[model samples]
Structures are given as structure tokens and as C-alpha cells.
Target chain A: MTVSDIQKLLNAKVLSCNEKLNMEVTNAFASDMMSDCLAFAKDANVLITGLCNPQVMRTAELLDIECIIFIKGKEPTDSMITLAQNNGICVLMSEYCMFETAGILFKTGEIGGATVGC
Target chain B: MAADNTIKLHYDVPNDDFTRAGEASSDLKGKLKQMGISPDAIRKVSIALYEGEINMVIHANGGYIDAEISENGLKLVLCDTGPGINDIVQATQAGFSTALEQTRMLGFGAGMGLPNMLQNTDDMIIDSIVGVGTTITMFIKM
Candidate 1:
């Protein structure tokens, strides 16, 4: 799927780096814990997270994640947007909660494999 | 390549500053990318070193990172002057975290830092002294 597909499916608003919407993403990982996201989210290009912080963008950079979808209507700050822009990461905001967003994406077969306990 | 060909990068991690935690790792990743390192090796080094950098901020109150990159691979040395880990065995466990509740609020401290570092690096060594400091050496061979 593409970032545009995810944005439309989740009814998300593109907050930053809109130029990246055409990027392809084959997998999704949802987590509020950055540590777990870093530990187990292997090869997942889209992170569905409720955490809105600059570190979220940093995590995306380290993992080579192209997009970050903030769930539960959480808005990212300007610094977060700037960080995403600098890192070439797309930031999206979804009004749906994490569970609903994950379920929606999972049903679409976009969500990746289950991450085992580390 | 010879040892003289190695590129050495150093960073001073600030204490209790969650916002600035990953800057060093980000800079290092860009440097490696510019050097045309393999993507897989760059990914491994980034994740491992980023985790170590976060650990330094959240647990050690601050630290220093020295990364040496060469044709063979990357070597990272992270040293912090803070409360040392009392149990290396337990600390290496996946769900073991000594972070305070405040740190957890920042969406970290899930106890996956050290284990994740170990998972991404080819070799890692931890040296610590109670009430003194901890030094972690990690290497990822190309």
C-alpha cells in the first residue's frame, strides 16, 4: 500500500512531508512504546503510534520507517513536524483510536507479522 | 582497509533530555550513508546505537558516545557516569527496566533497550562499577 492509501483508509490528515505520500509501504506496526517499536518492528515501514514527540520521528529515521500515523486524533507539535520534514518522514493524524486503526489496517492485510515478546 | 582509514565520531549525550536523545545516532546514520555503507549494516548500527543513546539519557543521566566506522564495520563505545546496573544478567532481560515512572511517560523505558542493542549488534560488552559508571562497547561487523 501507499501512504495515500493509508491516509484515505484511516481518514487521516497529512501533517508534514506530503510529498512522500506516493511512497510504498508494505507493513505497519502499532505501539505507543518507542522501545518495543524499536525492538520488534522489523521491516515495518509505517508506524501507527499515539505518541506525539520528536523521538517518534527519530525512531522512524533509525528504523527506516517512511511514515508515522498518529492515532486517537493526537496532533504533532511544530517541532515534531519539522523533525519529520527533516528526516523525510510523512506524518499523518488519524481520529480513530489505536485499536480501531490497527484493526482497519490489519483487515486490509497491510499490517505485518506479529512481533514476538522480546 | 587499515585502522588509519577509520572515521571516528564523538557525541556528548545530555542528561534527562529525552528530546535530544537520538541526535547522535541520526548524525551517525547520515555519515554512514554518505560513506556508502551497506543498508543492512547501517540499519543495524543505527538501531543499536540509538538504543544505547536512549539508555544513556534515561538511565545514566547522560553519557558520551564514540563511534568508529571502517570498511570492516562499526564499533560504538558509550560511557556514562550515573548509577550503574546492579545486575547485568537481569538487566539484559527483555522486560527488566529500572527507569522511573516519568521516563515511562516519554514512551520509552519498556526494558527493551539493552536487549534490542544486543539483538542488532554482532558483539557487545558491558563494564560497570556500582555508584561509578558503565561503559558499553558494541560492534557490528560488515
Candidate 2:
């Protein structure tokens, strides 16, 4: 699925990366813990997190996460958005809670293909 | 590459600024890539050492990180002067963590930091003095 597809599926708002919505996301991981994501995530994947902080983006940079979905109606701060944009990682915001966001993405075939925990 | 060795990088970690936590690891990643180390080796070192570095800054009030790269493997040493671990066994447990509530709120402190480091690195050794400091050494063979 693409970033645009994720936004349309979850009815999320493109808080950032308005121009890069067409980027394809092969898989996704939803977690509030940056360490788990860093420890497990493999290759390019979308990170669906409820945590709002610059460190989230930092984690994404290290793991090369392609996109970030902020669940629970949370919006990233300006610094977070700026960092994401600078790193070329798409940032999306949605009103749905974490479970719902992961459910939609998973059901839509953006499965966990990141080879995590292997 | 040095004599029977290769490249070495050392960084001083500052504990006060949480914002600067991953800078050193990020730099090392870039350097490793430029040196043409295997992606697998670099990834293991990056994840393991990054977690250790974060732990030092957050829990140990800052220290130093040294990474020596050779044809055989990568050696990482992390030393910190903060509240040392009283129970090394419990601290090694996967779900044990002493991070503050605020740190957890920032998406850390799940107690997986040390375990994650252990899991990622090929070998790891930790030394600590309760009222003094702690030193952790890790290696990932190429």
C-alpha cells in the first residue's frame, strides 16, 4: 500500500509529506516503544506509534522506517514534523486509536513484512 | 585500517541532552557504511550500541563510547558514571527497567534496552560499581 492509501483507508490527515503521498509501503509495525521497533524492524516499514516526540523520528531514521502514523488523534509537534520531512519520511495523523489503525493497515494487506524478531 | 587492525572511532556522550542521544551512533553508522563494512555487521552494531548509548545517557548521566573496527569484528565499549546497577541479573531480564515515567512517556524504558543490546550483539560484558559507575563491552564479529 502507499502512503496515500493509508491515509484514505484510515481517513488520516497528511500532517506532513503532502507531496510524497504516493510512496509505497510494503509493511507496517505499530508500537509506542521506540526500542522495540529499533530492535525488531527490518528494511523499510511504516511505524504506527502513539508516542509524540523527536526521538520517534530519530528511531525511524536509524531503522529507515518509511512512514509514520500517529494514532489516537495525536499530532506531531513542529520539530517532529520538520525532522520527518527532512528525513524524507512521510508523517500521517489519524483519529483512530492504535488498535484500529493497525487493524486497518493489516487488513488492507500492509502486513508485517519487515522480518522483525528473526 | 591500522596494523592488524582497521578504523577506530571514539565519542564522548553527554548525558544532559536527551535530544542528542543518537548522534554518535548515527555518525558511526555513516562512517561504517563509507568504510564498506557489511550491512549486517553495521546493523547489529548500530542497534546494540545505540541502545547502550541511550541507556548510558538516560540512566548513567553520560560517559564515553569507543568503537574499533577490524577485519575480524567490531568492538564497542561503553563506560558511564551514574547510578550503577545493584542487581545485574535482574537488570538483564528482558522486562526490567528503571527509567523514569517521563522517559517511558517518550517511548523508552520498557526494560528492553539491555536485553535488546544483548540480543543484537554477539557477545556482551557489563561491569559496575553500585555507587560509582558501570562499564559495558560488546562485540559483533564480522
Q: By lDDT, who's the top model here?
A: 1
| CAPRI tier of model 2 | medium
Which pairs of residues collide in candidate 2?
B1-B6
For candidate 2, the per-residue lDDT at B137 reads 94
Q: Which residue runs of candidate 1 sit more than 4 Å off their true CA positions?
A: A114-118
List iRMS for all predictions. 0.8, 1.0
Clashes of 2: 1
- List TM-scores for all candidates, in order: 0.95, 0.91
Give the lowest summed-lDDT range of ten residues in model 2 chain B: B1-10
CAPRI-wise, candidate 1 is: high
Give the whole-model CA lDDT for all candidates, comma-separated: 0.89, 0.84
DockQ of each: 0.86, 0.69
Q: Which ten residues in a row have the lowest lDDT in candidate 2 chain A?
A: A109-118
